[model samples]
Target: MWDRIEPLMPADPVRGRRWADHRRTLGAIAWKYRTNSPWRDLPEELGSFQTAHKRLIRWAVDGTWEKIFAAVLAAADALDDIDWTVSVDSTVVRAHQHAAGALKRGPKAEASRLTTHSDAPAVG
Candidate 1:
């Protein structure tokens, strides 16, 4: 997989790290996402959380992840490796006021400050 990815990645060096390659950086990113752990908790074998986090933020900004995924998917499809038979979808559930733990009695906090879709991939 890394062999396929090597040519697609930029050749720029990550600040403060001379030996880290694109494959290691991407693998570290995937490992972090798969485990859903805090960046600080990433295992040492994956390199510094700073490195992986910077890569994620950079890719998120530059759309590198989308490109990489598309390339991977294209490669898989060319090899007839994907399951084209299945479909999947999701629906958002809207709950009533009572469902929210916020109480009407307390000082109203700044509402809906959280954005679940920050840098989230679009699915059509």
Candidate 2:
């Protein structure tokens, strides 16, 4: 898979410090999402989590990922390996009571806060 993607990555900038190995950085990124863990939790062999995070964001903004996706799809289509089938699933999960905007301590508590003091003595 790296063979297919490596070529799609952008060339390292000429002025800045050279980038970390693209393959290693990509592995770190994949590990992060696959485990649904924060970037700070990335394993050591994957290199610095910060580098992985930054690379992911940089690639996204420069459209490297989109280019990789398009190239992979074209390759698969050439091999007649793509099914091109689409599936949509609708699933619903109910929200918690508080998430539904339920009132705290019912309407009576809210009404008291809304009432004004009549005997405060109006300013002239």
Candidate 3:
């Protein structure tokens, strides 16, 4: 996987501070996201979490991650390795409370003031 991903990383054009090893940094990033762990909790053998986090953010913002994913998918498809089937399990996936229209606490009073007339009973 790293072999497929390493070539997609953009090379630094100018010489300054040396970049961390691509494999180690990539491993750190993968572990952080895979485990949903905080960046600070990344293992030392994988290199600095800050570096991995920064690189991930930078690549995402600049579309490097997207490019790499697309390239990998294309390769897989070319080799007839992709499965086109799709599945959804509602029992294992749930919407957040906010997405389910749970009321936000602080804005209700302000919202009612804006909607209700002072001299009249409020209508639903």
Q: Candidate 1 residues 3-107, lDDT tens each?
A: 777777766766755646677788888888899988899889888889889888988888787888899999999999998686677788888887975545544
The TM-scores, one per candidate, come to 0.63, 0.70, 0.67
lDDT string, candidate 3, 16-114, tens digits = 877888778878988998999899999889988889999889888989989889989988988999988889777766799979866567867568555
Query: For candidate 2, lDDT tens digit of each residue in 2-95?
Result: 7888888999899989999999998898899999998899999999999999999999999999999999998998999998678888889899
Superposed model 3: Cα runs more than 4 Å off: 13-15, 89-124
- Runs in model 1 deviating more than 4 A are 13-19, 85-94, 98-124
Models sorted by TM-score, best on top? 2, 3, 1
lDDT of model 2 at position 50: 90
Clashing residue pairs for model 1: none
Q: What is candidate 2's CA lDDT for residue 111?
A: 76
Deviation of model 2 at 29, angstroms: 0.9
lDDT of 2 at 25: 93
Candidate with top TM-score is 2
Name the candidate that leads on lDDT.
2
With a 3 Å backbone cut-off (N, CA, C), the pairs that clash in candidate 3 are: none
Off by over 4 Å in 2: 84-87, 93-124
- Cα RMSD of all models vs. native, in order, equals 13.3, 8.6, 7.0
